[model samples]
Target: MERYVLTVTLNAAVDVAYTVPGFSPGGIHVAAAVRRVAGGKGNNVARVLARLGVRVAATGFAGGAAGRFIQDELRRAGVVPEYVEVAGESRTCYAFTDPETGVVTELRERGPELGPEDVARFKARYDRLLAGAELVTISGSVPPGVEPEIYRYLIERARSCQVRVVLDSSGQPLREALVARPYVVKPNRAELAGWAGRPLETEADVLEAARRMRTAGPEWVLVSLGADGALLVGPDGAGAWRAVPPQVAALNPVGSGDSAVAGLACGLVRGLGPEELLRQAVACGTANARTAGVADVDPAEVERLARRVRVEPV
Candidate 1:
C-alpha cells in the first residue's frame, strides 16, 4: 500500500507578502504588489510536496478566521488539511521585499497559546494520522504555552508506528528533540551554528559540527548552505556528501528551506539513493529561490535544475 507524507506545523499563520521598489527604515514606502497565502514551515513543505505530485497531509493547531483561511488556501493548493482546532485565533505574518535588493524583512506575530486541553486534542489527532504516514516532517516553532518537549513526544510517537521522521526546528525545541533521534534533521548553516553556540567559519568546521550533531541522535544531518547548496553527513558520521546547486538569481527565499525538506521527503518516499536525494533536495531549494511566492515551485524548473546539481561524496 502507498503511504503519504504528513507535515506538522505547530504555529501556523496567514502570510502576506508585499513587494516594494526599495526599503528605507523610518521612511514611508508603498507596495508594488501584494500576495497572501497560508504559511508555516510544515505547511510550506506540504504545499511543495503536493506540487511535486506527492501524497501529503498538513496538520497542526489552527483556529479563528486566519486558521480558516489557511485551511482554504491549502485545499486550493491541493494539500490535505488535517488541523486540530483551538480556542484562540491564529497568527499573521508579513514579509516586505525590496525588488532591487532582493532583501526581505519579516514581521511575525506569536501564535495563540495552547492549553493542556488543546495539547491533548492535537495529540489524539496526530496519533490517528500517523497510521497512514510513511514519513513525517515536523517543522516550525511551537505556539506559546507549548513545551519544547512536544517535538520529542511526536518523534517518539512516529517511531512507535515505524514511521520515518524529518525534523526541522531550532533553539530549545531542536535541542530537546535531538534526544528522540529523528530519522533526519534538516538545519541551515545558521541554525547549526546556533546549536553549536559558536560561529562556523570554514567548511571543515561545518562538517565537524554536523558530525558532532549526528552523534547526538539524528541518522542524517542535512545542513543547507543556501546558494552554495547543502552538506549531508550520514548516521555514523563516516559517510558524507556535498551537493552543489544550479546558479539562479533568487527573488525571494522565504520558504526555500521548507521546499528542500519536501524534496528530501520525496526522495525518501521514492527510495532514491543518497546522492540523488541530495541533488533533488538542492534542486527544489533552488527552484523556490527563483520564485517570489513561498513554496511556489515550478516542477519543470526543478527538473532542469536537478540536472545541473553536482553531488560528490566527501
Candidate 2:
C-alpha cells in the first residue's frame, strides 16, 4: 500500500544558487551568499509535492559525487529517491541573482553523457517504480541521443500499467509525448510558443496554443504565463488564466511553473474538479514567485492567492 507519485528526471542536476551585489562582466565583486539544492524539473516538482504533504518517490539518473549530493539533498527535503547510478559526474546548473537589478542569470550545462546501457538500466528502474505509483510524472530535458520519443515511451508504459501520466517537458520531447498522450502536460510560455510555431503574446494566443498542444497528444494541457498566471485546457475543457494581478509584488519567476505542476498532480491525486485544481495550481505558482532562491513555496500564500485566482473563458 505504498501510495506515491513517481517523478522522472532524465537531465537531473545539482543546482547552485548565489546572489551578488550589482554585477558587471569582469568586475571584481564579493559574493553575497550561495546555496546548493537538489534540482531538475521532476525533482523540483517532487519538492513542491512533498511540501504540500504528498508522498513522492523521485526516480532519475545520477552520477558521481555531485549526483550523490543531489540524492542526499532530496532526502533532507522529504523526497526519497529511487536513483539509478551512472558513470560520469552529474552536471551543475547555476543561478546568478543580482539584488540591485532584481535579475537572475542562468548558466545551464548540457548534462553528463548517458550511454545506451545506462539508459536501459534507468528504464528498468522506471518500470519497477511505476508498478507502485498512482501517478507517473516525467519532467525536464531529454538528453542528446536519447530519443525525443522517450516521453512517449514512458507514457505508453504508464498507460499499460493503468497509472495516470503527468508530463512537464519542452521542445521535441513535448512533440513526441503527444503521440502517447499523457493524462496531463504542463507547458510554459516559450515552450508553448514553439509548439504553436508562433509567439503567444496574448491570452487568446495562449489558449489557442494550448489546444494545439493538446491536439498533439496530452489529454489535458496547462499553459503557464509567468506574472500573468496560468491556463488549463483539456477534456475538462476548463480554460482559464489566473492573473497575478498588477500589484502583487512579484519576485523570482523561477520554479513557479514547476510548483504549479506539482499542484496539478496533487489535485489529480485528490480527485479535485477542474476549477479547484486550476485555483490551487495558481496558488502554488504565485507562492513560489514570492520565495527567494529556494523553491519552497509558502502554503499559506497558496491558500490566500487561491481565493483571488481569476479564471476566465478562453
Candidate 3:
C-alpha cells in the first residue's frame, strides 16, 4: 500500500524540555515543573498527524544514546521512524514554557555534521521512502557539511517519484530549493521577506512577494503569520485571511506550524481544495496553541476552531 505521507527530518534530534514559573535573571522561585521528551520538526509533525489517525513514517539521521533515546521516544509515541545511524549522536533542543505568560523560550542545537558518505546514505534512504509516500514534507535547517542545495536535490528527487514535496526552510537552503519548485513551500513572514530581498510590510506586500516566488516554481506558497493567520498562493487559489483563535487562552505556541502542515497535507492527500486546506490549517494551529509541548490537540477542539476559520479567496 502506498503510504499517505512521508516526513523527512534531516536535522533530527531528541528534544529535552523543561518548564519553570517566574523565571528571573539570577534567581529562581521555589515552585515549578519540568518535562523531557524526544522532538524534532518532522517528528513533531508526524506525532500530530499520527495522533489524528494519519499513518506516517519519520525518516532521518540518529546516533549515540541521544539518538537511541529519540528513536525510543518516537516508537513509544507510536511514530514509526526510519532513522539512519549517522556518525554523531542526535542533538538536543530545549524549551522552557512559562505557564503564567504563555511564552516559550527555545535553545536549539546546530545539529550534526554530515560527511559526503553520510549524505549519500540518507539520500538512498529518502529515495526508498518516497516510493511509498503520496506527500512528502522535507523540513528544518541544513546540517553541517550539507550543501545548501539539499532541499532542491531532495525536492527534485521526490517529485520524480510523483511525491508532492513541501519545503519549510529558510535562508540559502530555501532560496536554493526555489529553483527546483517543490509542490508547496511554507515560509513565515520573515523568511518570505528574506527570499523577496525586501521587507514584506502589508497583506499586499505578502501577496506580491509570494507572486514573485512563483517564478522560482512552487505550485503553492503558504506564508504563516503568528495569530494573524496565513496567506495562500497558487493553483488551487490565492487568498488572504485572519485566524480567529478560540475563546480560550493560548497555553503554548510550539509546533503550530507543523500542525498546519499536517492539516494541509492531510487535505491535499485527500484531494481537497485551498478553502478546505486553510480551514483545517487554521484549526490545527489553534489546536496547537491550546496545548503544552508536543501534546496533541483534541480533534473536537479542532472542529470548534474549524467553524471559526474564515477564508477570503483572492
Top candidate (lDDT): 1
Which scores higher on lDDT, 1 or 3? 1
Say which candidate scores most in TM-score.
1
Tell me the spans in candidate 1 whose CA falls farther than 4 Å from its real position: none
Q: Candidate 3, which segments miss by more than 4 Å at Cα?
A: 29-31, 236-247
lDDT (tens digit, per residue) of candidate 3 on 1-314? 84768888888877765666765557765436665666777877787777777888888888788888878887887778888888777788877777877667788988878899988898998888888888898778887888999889999998788778877889999988988889888888898999889998898898888877876888888888768778888753454444444555777777888888877777788788777787888788778887875646677888888888877765
Cα RMSD for candidate 3? 2.0
Ranking by TM-score: 1, 2, 3
Q: How high a TM-score does candidate 1 get?
A: 0.98
Worst 10 contiguous positions by lDDT, candidate 3 = 236-245
Considering only N, C-alpha and C atoms within 3 Å, which residue pairs clash in candidate 1? none
User: Which portions of model 2 show Cα errors greater than 4 Å?
Assistant: 236-246
lDDT of all predictions: 0.94, 0.83, 0.79
TM-score of each: 0.98, 0.95, 0.93
> Could you tell which candidate, 1 or 2, scores higher by TM-score?
1
Clashes of 2: 2
